[model samples]
Each structure stands twice: as structure tokens, then as C-alpha cells.
Target: MSSTDIEPAESRRPARYHAKREAILAAAALAINEQSAKGLTLADVGRRVGLTTTSVTYYFKKKEDLAAACFSRTLDKLLEILDQALEEPTPQLRVRRYLSLHMARLARIQAGQEAPFAVLSDLRAMEDPLRGQLLAGWRTVFRRTRSLWGSPATRVHADLYGARAHLLLEKTFWLPVWLDRYDAHEFDRLEARMMQLLTHGVAAEGQSWAPELIPLVQIQDDETVNRDAFLRVATRLMNEVGYRGASVERISAELKVTKGSFYHHMDAKDDLITACYDRSFNIMTTAQRLSDTVAGNHWRRLSSVLASILNLQLANGEGLLRTTALTSVPAHEFALMLERSHRIAQSYAGMISDGVAEGSMRPVDPFIASQGLVALQNAAFDMRSWASTMPRERAVALYASSLAFGMFDDRVLEAL
Candidate 1:
């Protein structure tokens, strides 16, 4: 080889470094998605990339560092997508552009052309400065997404637009869980259908937001109150942190009870989480069932179920366990939890299908709309703080109406 053709040591080193670092990040993201931040280990990530744990340390000094990097990469990608979407001339076009770009990216991942982004559900499980940093990045992503609907001129506009922003991002985050059901060739058609729902909404020409309250079947006095207490605390902790982060000791300490007391109510940590899921699903089923008993159009029944659930989520008592916990849930139990979730989604789908048939709703894809509803309700727990500022009824209407109405409809504001 000619001496002039030989690359400098500095150039060769940087190229090699960049390639290895990218590989490590890709592997770490996949591992975190599978097992969550708590389950991530340097050794596991290294094994995926054909490196020793010690060698991996050369790129990221700690597991938390690697996890943070993974989250940062995801935020970076989101900001990039938002930037592309913002270039469009109108809010509707911006939203359509955003979803189209994001769907394309997800399809690429599904087709093995790119690595997956780390799931942001476990962001709370990380320790500070990493946690703080990741959260700030996420807030930026959220603010940029909210901008897709245009700038808000008042507090009410801000809240309304904020709800729309959350709804959009949550559905985007939720795509990976169900997007694989479609063939890669169907992505364009799916995106168009999804955008229709996002822009126009599920309501018919003049469907109103007058949801009758669906009464839940109250728990009997004979039920063990202590077990309910455990579920409440565990559910909140798990929502704040994650499944593994909400350990037995943590739950016991929060309840001011002994570890023995915890075991007395539940068999194990897994059992507690499983029970939490059961409780959430039961509440959902009760609302769905009771809505069926109500006399109205399908939209009335659907809106009642949605409003009632949002009420439960915003109340001071125990709320539903978010689907984000699925990331840290054990594999064996994961499928079971997901099955229950699918059934709840199917209930929503059935209502939507009937509404469409009865001409009470727009001709939206029921499966897609149902999934969007799930994303809306599942993420409402995080909106409790936002919900607190206004009257509970107004909060419910504003937030629930994000999907109950469409992204562009703001008549819900006039009612408030």
C-alpha cells in the first residue's frame, strides 16, 4: 500500500469510535425496550454488540449513563420529526406531515432498516441529573408538538392545545405496540386513515359532548380494605417509577406496614401488580357494561364511559395503573395484561362500530379509533396536575374531547 494512501491515526480512530458507539446505543435501546431501564445492564448491552462489559464502559461509564443516552437519542429523533412537521403551512397539514413522517420511521424499524428507539415510559425510573435532563428534553418535545396546532393566545387556549398535544404524542408513542399488525405496504393507507381521525375526529356532523354519567358498581363492604390500600399505593408508585422500582420494601414502607403485612394481602410483588391490573381492568369493564345499560345513541354510551373513567383517574383516590408498566412487567404476565387491555379496547371498538353503523359517528376506522381512545385514557393519569387547575367537569370535557371531538374542533371551549 502507498504511504500517501494510508489514513491518519486520528481519522481512523474517530471513524471506529463512532461506529462502535452507534452499535452500543442500538443494542442498549433494544434491551431497554425489552426489559426496561431497571433490567438494563452493561453486560447485557455488551453481549448484544459483541463487546465485553469493560469495553462498553469505555463508551458509557455506567448503566444509567447508557440508559440516559438511549432516552436522549429518542428525544432527539422526536425533535427532528417535529421540526420537519413544523415546516408545513397549516396546523392540519403539520399534524398530517408529522404522523406520516413518524409512521415512516416506525415502518423502517419494523422492516429492520433501523434500530428501535428506547421506550420513554421508564424515564421516571432513572436517577437524577439524568432523570432531570431526560425530562427537560421530553418537555421540549412536548412543547414543539403542541406548537403543531399553532400558538395559544390565552390560558384556555394553552390548556386546550396542551390536551391536543398530549393526545397526539401519546398515540404516536402507542403506534409501535400495534403497528406491526399491518403489512409495510399498507403504511400509507393506514397513515391517511389515522390522520383523518386526528384531523376530523370520531363524531358525526353534530354529535355533542353531553355524556351521561355511568354509575360504577361500588365495591362491597366485605372486601378487604387493606388489600385495596396496597393496590392504591403500589399503583401510584408504579406509575411514578416503574414495576421493578416499586419494590415490596418501598410499598411496605409507604403503607407504614411490615413486609409480612404486604405478603398477607398479596402473594408477591408480581401478584400485587397483577392485582392492580385486574382492578384497573375491572373498573374499565364496569364502566363499559353500565354504559350498555344506558338509553341513548352509541356516541352517548361511548362518551359516558370515557367521561366516567377520566373522573376516576382525576379523583383523589386510587387511579388506574397505566399501560406504561407493561415495559417492566415480566414476560409471562405481560401477555395476560395485554390480552385484558385488548378486550377493553375491543369494547371501545364495538361502541364505535355501532355508532358508525347508526350514523352517529363519522366513518372512522374503529380499530384505529379504539386504539387512540386507549392511548387517551391510559395517559390521562399523567394529566391530573393539569386537570386540577379547573373545575373537574371542565377538565374532563377539555381532555376527553380531544378525541371525543377532533383535533380541529374547539367548540368544547365555548361550553366551558
Candidate 2:
């Protein structure tokens, strides 16, 4: 054939290739929704879209590359939303609209349809250039977000408003795990409950922060165990900020102790971080085992487990490391925390599966439900600042109910 005769076929090939790439990206996003970017595999994504793993690589060579692409997509979507939110005349209204719109989008994404934006499974998984680019983009949105409460001249005041807004926005990002099939009405109710908790704090009704002397390894013995108060405060700092952001110097200062005191207990900052993850996972697993013995079927048992986790986070200082995903830890310790965390998630899923079999709970995807439950459990730790505002029990009950029925009262859910 003449070269001209083959031109049309060759031209169409690139178009077809780009279309396939887009399909793979969409499929990857859905798969990541099920099991974040860290847990996602090229093979699984390929299977979901009816492509071979080898074929999938033709579009994105490495899983991290694909992950980076996913992260970029989510970041762009987030930036777009933040931009639209800025169009609102006031900051609070902007924040509310941003959240409500984002919640509705979550429902769409989980349902395997189009969404307003995308999400990243693991930020650390992406390369520096890609990760930095996306994060820088996010900062722009955040700066605008901070302005919602009016620009505070004081850094601390600005931070408080930013923290509250970000905390509320962060939880909705994980709603796919909680209510994959929710409608507009459900999103509105869920948003209302969230806003209520956000503005008023999680104090159940008339109660205020009633400090109890609950022990959490609350042990004060050896230098490694608890010789200094730095570790306890470190746990909170790490949970509130992150390991990188929670440096030894900062943590020591926060405890009103010297760096020497912090050094006296742990070998280094990384070691301290490792210890924190170890302690956090150990506490959660212990709670899980204890809840396993609670009276009733899987649903009740799950509730008891949720209660135990939420209360521990609220009651104990060490439980302050509130991240649901462990990828944030240094790569070396990632596997250990992830394995243990996965087991915990599975235990939750197993309970849902059991309840379904036992006829004690409504039908649901055990895997997604378990992941959703754990996400809620982890996020509850962030409510510590608000915990002091009300009765801890009331806050815990509200969290439990929110997990069971997203944006719903039990009565409202039943009527639906």
C-alpha cells in the first residue's frame, strides 16, 4: 500500500490509544476507591477494565506512575472545586457549598459514574516532581479556604479556623467507604450532622469535657515506656500533624521538656515515630480483641468495637495517632503498620460478613463497610479538641450512629 493509503489507520491508532488510556485511568480510580493507591495493583485494575496487566502498562508503565496520575487527577478536581467554592460571596457559605458539593460527588464516584474530582491513595508513592506539583496546587486551595473565616492577623487564629475547616473537609473525602449509594437527601442530612459536630464539637448533648483517669499503657515506668512526658505529647502531635511535621524539637517544646529529656528515652526521631505507630496499633488491636468478647451478634459487636476505638482515642493520649492509612509513616515501617491495619480492617469486614450470615444486619459490602468503619474510627481521634466541649459518651454515640447510617438518624433511615 502507498504511505498515503496507511495514513488514516495510523492516525486513528493514537486516538484509540488515548481513549483506552482514559478508560484505564477511570478504572484505576474506581479500584483505588476500593483499596487505596497503596493497596491497588495493576493486575486488579486491568481485570476490572477487561485489559491484561501487560496491556495496562502500555499506557502507564509503573503502578506508582499510575498512582501519581491518579493523585494528579484528584488534586485537579479538588482545585476546581475550591475555585468554584471561592465564587461564593462569603467564606462560611463557600466552605459549606464546597463540602456539600464534594459529598454529592463522592456518591457519584463510588457508584462508578463521573465525579467532580478524584483522590490520591498514597502521596508518598508519587515522585517528588509530581507530588510537589500536586501539593503546591492544594496549598492554593487551602489559602483560599483559610480566608473563608476572614484572614486572621494572628497565625494561631488563622490556624484554628483552617484546622476546623480542613478537618471537616478531610472526613468527607473518605465518604465513599461510608455511603457509596447515598442520594442528595442523604448527603444533605450527613452534611448537617457533620456541620453540627464541627461547629459545636462532639460533646453529646449538655455534657462538657469530663476528664477521666483512663489508663492507656498509661504506664509511667522506664525511659522507653514513659520516663518523660514527651512521648505522650508526641503521640498527639504526630496524630495532629504528621511524623515529618512532628519533630523532636517541636514535640519536646510542646511537652515543656528539654530535647535532652526526649533523647534520653528514644534513640532518634524516626525511632520515636516507629514506637508511636507500634503503640497506636497495639492499643487498637487490644481494643479489637476485647470487643470480640462483647455480648451480641456481629453488628452489636462491631458497634462495641467502634465504641472502644473511638473512646480510646478520646480518652487516651497515645491513641492520638489518628490516621486511617499508614502510608504516611516512613517507607521502612509502612509494611508493618499496613499489615496490622489490614488485619484490623478485615476483622471489621468479617464482622459485617458474619452479621449478614446471621441475619442480624442489613446486606452490605463487608470489605467497603469495614474500611469505612475504620476510617470513621481513625477520624474520630481528630475530635479531641472538641471532646472537651461535651459529654464524651454523647460524642461517641453520635460517631457510632454516623458510621452506621451516613447523614441519617436510625428512624429517618428506616423510613427511607
Candidate 3:
């Protein structure tokens, strides 16, 4: 054979190697999204890509390394999108273009034209150097997302922009979970409706930001059990780590109790998580029901419920377990938890619908706005440090303002 022919055949080795490596990454990302970074098994990832565990290890030496690579790729993709968005001349156009591009990317993934990005909810599950690296990448993505709102002129503006950036990024992260519910052809309309809500918010013309604070009532069933401490500690751990990352042993250690004490309060780890969910849902439902009794318009009721829940999230006391843990939930229980979440979102949607009818809220899509509200409150736990810098009420107001008014609105600064 000629030397040129031998050289061409040898050159194909690198291209084939890269192609197989990309395939492994795509499979790993999908598996990580299905289970979680902690729950991911090299064997499982290998099976998804029709390779042996050792073969997968050739591409990624360890499972944590593989998971971190997946997260890094996602962060890289997000930064690219943000860079594209920065090309716009105005913040409004930048935000719109960002959403447009992001929604299109999601649509392409749904259409099987692109590989799925690993969900970053499980970043906390990773250990050591990987965790630090992923966090730094996240900070970069956050900073770029903040830049979508243009440069902040003042400290207060910076805070407002940070909150807005968080809201926007969380909503984008949240889209994949619910996007499957819509048809691919309808993605354009969905994007347009979401953009409208993000632009004008849910408030009607001449509406102000004042919302009554609703008192919370203790759940009756929870009062029957003296496991509040266990549930609270468990919820906190789960919120910090993920579901699988927050093991029974970890919860017991945090509570300074033995495994026996934990078992005494709860039957199993799943049961404990279920109790935490119940407690959170009860708190939310209590706020919603109490808001109904407040003497005001639908917008008032909605804002009060949001503020009350956000306050619960920001307070030093026991806070809501983030929905990010859902990724680690068992398949059988996932449906039930999702159903409960859907009901709460429906309650928010009902309020939005009433607000629109009563001329208190803008004529935006109730379903989209309600889901946006869910994304907002669920992500508030991440901003507790930011909240600590100001009064709890002001933190609640400022954070909730992202969705209450609009991502672009700075009225919350004046409202306080």
C-alpha cells in the first residue's frame, strides 16, 4: 500500500475516537438528568451508550469526573448563549433574544437535533475539586446572565439585577421539566407568551406593589407528630445537597441523633422526605388559603401568598425543600410529588385568572405566569445570603418582585 493511503487510514483514528467520546458524553448527560449526579452509576451510563463500564471509564476515569464533565459542558453551552445574547444593543432586546435562542435550543433537543444538557440541580452532590470548579463555572454563567440586564449603576441596582438574573436563570433551568407537556410546533407561541409575562409582569395598569402579609396556620396532622425537628433538619440537608446526597445517616448526624432516633421519628428515608414535602405543601397551602381571606383584589391575594412563602424561604427557621431534589426521587413517588406540585401551580394559575378578570393583573398567560411563580419561590432558597443583607420583608419583596412586577421592572426599589 502507498504511504499516503496508510497515513489517511491512521488519521481517521482521532476522528473516530472523538466521535465515540462525544457519544459517551451525550449518553452521560441524559442519564445524569434522569437520575442525578449522586445516583448516576458508570454501569448505567455505559448501558445507555451500549458500552462496557471499562469502556466508559476509558472516556471518563471516574463517575464524578464524568458528571463534572457533563456539568462543565452545560455551563459552556449556557455561557455561549449568554455571549450571543450580549450581542444585542439593549437589555430588553438582549433578554428577548436570550429567551428566543434558549427556547430554540430546547426545541432542537426535543426534535432530536441536539444532545441534552445535564441539569445543574445536582451540582451540590459532587465532591471536592469538581464541586469548586462547577461552582466557579456557575458563577460565570450567573454573571453573564446578570449582564443580560446591562450594567448596574448602583449597589441597589446590582442587587436588583442579581435577583433578576437568578430568576431568569432558574426559569430557564426549570423549562426542561415542563416543556415536554407542550407540542414542538407550539414552542414559538410558548416562548412569546413567556416573553410577554417577563416584560410586563402580571400587574395591571396603575397597580402598586403592596401585598398583605398572611398569617400561617399549623398543619393539623403535623401537630400530631413531634418530628418537626427531624423534618426541618432533613429538609435543610436535602435543600443543600440533593435527595440521594441527603442520606438518613447524614440527617441523623446533622441532628446529632443516632440512627435509632431518626427511625423513631420516621419509618424510612423516603417517608422522611415525604413528610418534608407535606410540611412544605402545608405551609404553602396555608398561605394560599389565608390570602383568600385578606380583604383585597386577586392581585393582592396572589402577591401576599407569594411574599409569605418567600419569607418562609428567606427566614432563618426551617425553609421549604427545593424542588431540585425531585430529580433524585424514586420513579413511583415522583408522580405523586409532581401531582401535588401541579395542584399548587393550579392554585396560582386560578389566582392569576381571577386577577386578569378583575382587571388587577395584565392579560398574560396564567399557566406560564403560575409556573414562573413556582420557579421563583423554589429558587429563593438560593438567595438566602442576599436576603440576609437586608430586612427579611425587603428581601422577600425584592426577590418576589422579579415575577410579581417583571424581570425588567425596577419599581420594587421605589416600593420599599
Best by lDDT: 1
Off by over 4 Å in 3: 1-13, 217-225
Q: Which residue pairs in model 1 clash with each other?
A: none
Please estimate how well model 2 matches the true structure, expressed as its whole-model Cα lDDT.
0.61
Question: Whole-model Cα lDDT per candidate?
Answer: 0.87, 0.61, 0.85
lDDT of 2 at 128: 68
RMSD from true fold, candidate 1 = 4.9
Give the alpha carbon lDDT tens digit for every residue of 1-416 in model 1.
11122357635667789789889999999999998899999999999999999999998899988898889888888888999999999999999899989899988988899999898989988898889878988899899999998989889889999889988999998998788889989999999999889878888888889988776635435534488788888998898899989999999898788899999998777787889998889989999989978788999899999999898787655578999888777798898899889888988999999999999999999999999999988998888888889888988999987787789889888888
Candidate 2 per-residue lDDT, tens place, 150-199, comes to 66655434434544444445566666544644565576776765554333
What is the C-alpha lDDT profile of model 3 across 1-416, one tens digit per residue? 11122345546668777678778889989888888888888899889888999998987899988888888888888888999999999888999999998999999998999998999988877898879878888998899999988888988889888899999999998898788999899999999999998888898878877888886634334323348877877888888888888888888887677899888988878787788898888888888888868788989889889888888787765689888787777887878988898899999999999999999999999889989999998999888889999888778888887787788888889977
The local lDDT score (0 to 100) that residue 264 gets in candidate 1 is 94
Better of 2 and 3 by lDDT: 3
Error of 1 at 224 (Å): 8.7
Error at 175, model 1, angstroms: 0.5
Ranking by TM-score: 1, 3, 2
